[model samples]
Target: MAEQFNFSSPPFDLLRAAERERLSEALSVGYYAAGETLIAAGSAVPCLFVVLKGVIEERGEDGKLFAQYTSDDIFDIRGLFSGSSKHVYCAVEESITYELPASVFHQLCGANPDFGRFFQADLAAKRQLARRDGQNLAEFILTRIAREHLLPAIEVSAGLALGDAARLQLSRGADALLVRQDGELGIVTRTDLMTAHFRDGRSEAEPIGPLAHGPLACVELGDFLFDAMILMTRKRIERVAVREDGEVVGLLHLTQVLSLFSTHSHVLAMRIARAESEEELRGAAETLHTLIATLCGNGIRLRFIMQLVSALNEQLLERLFELLVPPALRSRCCLLVMGSEGRGEQLLKTDQDNALILAEDLPVEQGLALMQRFSEALLSFGYPPCPGGVMASQPAWCKPLAAWQRELNQTQLEGQPEQLMRMSILADASPVAGNRQLYEGLRQGLLRFAQEGERWLPDMAAAALQFDTPLTILGNLKTREEHLDIKRGGIFPLVHGCRVLALREGLEERGTLARLGALKARGVLDEGLADNLAESFELFLQLRLQQQLGGARDGREHGLDVARLSRHERDLLRFGLHAVKKFKQSLAWQFHLESR
Candidate 1:
């Protein structure tokens, strides 16, 4: 058997000696009788089976055949890592399987970075195909809460008097009050009392009980913010009591979360908005670099922080435009950012790419003058002038809704490669302010036109595979002595691959992270796989920021060198980079890019 099989090749060739032994042991020879259901979808099981002999078919919930498992094929490890009961497909067959328990597999892989990378590479390949067929998309990528501060929860008994609660609230400078009553929970907030007493003629001293409200929604301390967001959205509540079972632990409030965004974002924006001098504005821009550091250090989710920072930038620019642009033009149009800024994925400041989409039939010269003023004001607010000169001040980018739509339609047909490349940025276009509907309409038209005949995706997929994964011919890991551009190499593959997937699927979530999640929900990508991509993108972003901050500290723009990364960071990067490589390969094969 050993002589017949090629173990000296990839994926098997990638595994370590210890890992090979573990795999052999895990693949014990056991036979299942015919008509046996080996594993069911959505079951929280500890182990995944690899076929040692016989065969199995993966079936969907509708009882239709999906994929058949044969020699060397793997199944169910995704579920093992996901720690979720939602299996995307079911296993069926009387088969001999090598059972790999999740715990042992995790330990074996953890100790061997190469072995772990090998498995992720294989999984990523399968996931790309699953993405197309809507089968095996979910790949598990771990997430950590990025919050820097967890404020202590102010506690009070449900029976505590209003006065005592008030004192506790004031003493602690806390906005939320948690009430544990009779082994259950409830809450009486400051707003609850202020409205009740002042508006409803209730006495403040009247036991806060009359106003207390709950079936106290709570989250465990260890649960991620994704968990917290789900609980908040599902319950329509502004706060959740952080709990260890029924015992009151801490409290998470929406205001606090928003404040976290504010601390890292709004302060710089506000400074920029209020600055009256060039020096002050430069100082504000310098402050922004620090805020970026804090946000990354706190482990803030890159996606959420991006949106928050983008919103603050919009606010800052809006105020600047109000101060600089003539009032009449401000009333007629808004300064909107397209592309990365539009998608709320921007972290570090790059180039300024934006346009003015004016209301129809405005006096042409007046509007042009207003845009000039707006562009100058943006410069004052620290946005560098666009190299492509697509700023609102540029007449080429500033147009009526009808003209913009026509331009987009023409770009699709002209098929000039350069124009098409420029058009790609349109995918990230988002409206920041005035005449937002106009921006939205233009975006819809572009999406409809680009994806309508399914003409754009194949080309986009073809372009996406242009970056080859830097895998060595001898199978040794490649390390860059100079900084590796994770954004160009790792992030772009997933971003462009996801964009093509979203366009094909008609997924309208414009942000890269949101698009991935939406695609997962639509079953175009699996939840676990989407999680992996999202996590990888975020980790890369986080590392990039760290590199930038270190450069800022040293007064030099030190590029990211993968070789310089700590052992643990390098291991993670290898896993993430390999995932991107395999995903691109999957895209190539699925869309027939290589053959084309």
Candidate 2:
């Protein structure tokens, strides 16, 4: 029976022989009678069960069966790692199964690098699925935050000296301070203290009052980690002083929130939310580059960070829309972000591509006023006005729901390059705020339109295939004398390629990596080839981020020359560019485009 099992597919495909053997042996066959409880709900979990030959069902707290499992299905692994007994698994049939004990699973995976990679890939796939399904399970989302939760009440009073506060912060080694002031939990950071004292010429004895920020925007401990994340971003602070009855009890630092996701995410959301003015947003925007740099330096997962940051950006723009648009019109219409922003893959901030879809037949004057307000608000929020003016402010983009469908239908019929180009941008649009149903309709309509006119998708693919990968004659990466625009030669190809694949597959995933994986999963892109393409996209993003950060560190406005990249960077860039070349070839074949 064990011999009949195939561990050939990813992530098991990456596992070393010894590691696979260890895992296989540890996966002992277990049998359960029908109606038997296999794993209890709300108990400390010990192992994950892979249903090999039986049916297992999960019942949620509502006592409603939520999930059904069959052969080759995996479940409860995240729970085992979380040490949470929150899921109940019961046998729906008298069945034989593979039970991988959490301890043995951890031991084997930890002891073997290949095993770790195998598990990581499997887990990442599961998470991507959960996200697409909108599961909203905290354990599914927070799996990457590996830090042990800190102890309670590491506090500092509001008026503590900067020197003393700095000492306390150093002693704690935590990135934040919780100040109990005005019946609210205010937070001040060591960075805040440092910036104020050293950069702003504030005195250490100047009464930490000047340094402390907040009137804590609160979140219940029982709330989703995303709740804490949202509050932190909304309040524009690094540390959120966790309060119980208005007294500081614990602290949630931005670093902790990021640790819950990954490193590159630490400041991404906060930076966007804290931009009180457009100038600040411009400065904060550059930090995205630094974030990329630091994440690359530490080898943090890049895909998750991209999703996380892009999600925050959407939220930020949504919030800005909510604040700026009049209550009535805001409710009557949806704000949609198109182009790369819509695709959930934007790295550097670029021209805003947005549109409005309003409830059918509203007063034209009111509708136009709302769009104008939203556009101005976004411009003030640091998104430059679109050069093409394909914004809500434009009558062409500000439309009723039926009108949008008509435009999309027209574009599909004509297959106009100009129209296709515009539709491609519109295709990427996601609802930033307002009437979400309108955006949902937009998504559904676009998906239907793309599917019905599938032949036109290859044309879009051909356009994406136009960007040549920067591979040199000796198979090295060619860099410009000034600086390589990774955006043009590398990132754009991946982004556009993914968009083409998304349109072809009717997959709604907006990120480049996600589209690549989804396409690969559907056998639209080969597995190894997809992985290589993803790696190149990640490396390109990482390098661009690093260059941006280096510029910021030097207090410069522009990025660095990719041609003069350091030795390690040069090698990595070459490797990534080669991968991009291969990815471009794949695109060419997919579209039947002749290579130049």
Among all candidates shown, the one with the greatest lDDT: 2
Off by over 4 Å in 1: 1-285, 363-368, 376-382, 450-453, 474-481, 526-528, 553-559
Give a tens-digit lDDT track for model 1, residues 287-388: 655666665565554665565556555655565656666666565675677656777676666567787777786665666787786677556655667877
Structure candidate 2, residue pairs in collision: 42-85, 43-85, 343-510
The lDDT of each candidate is 0.63, 0.67
lDDT, residue 250, model 2: 63
- Candidate 1's error at 15, in angstroms? 24
Model 2 residue 233 distance off true place after TM-score fit, in angstroms: 6.7
Per-candidate RMSD, Å: 14.4, 18.8
Candidate 2 local Cα displacement, residue 58, angstroms: 60
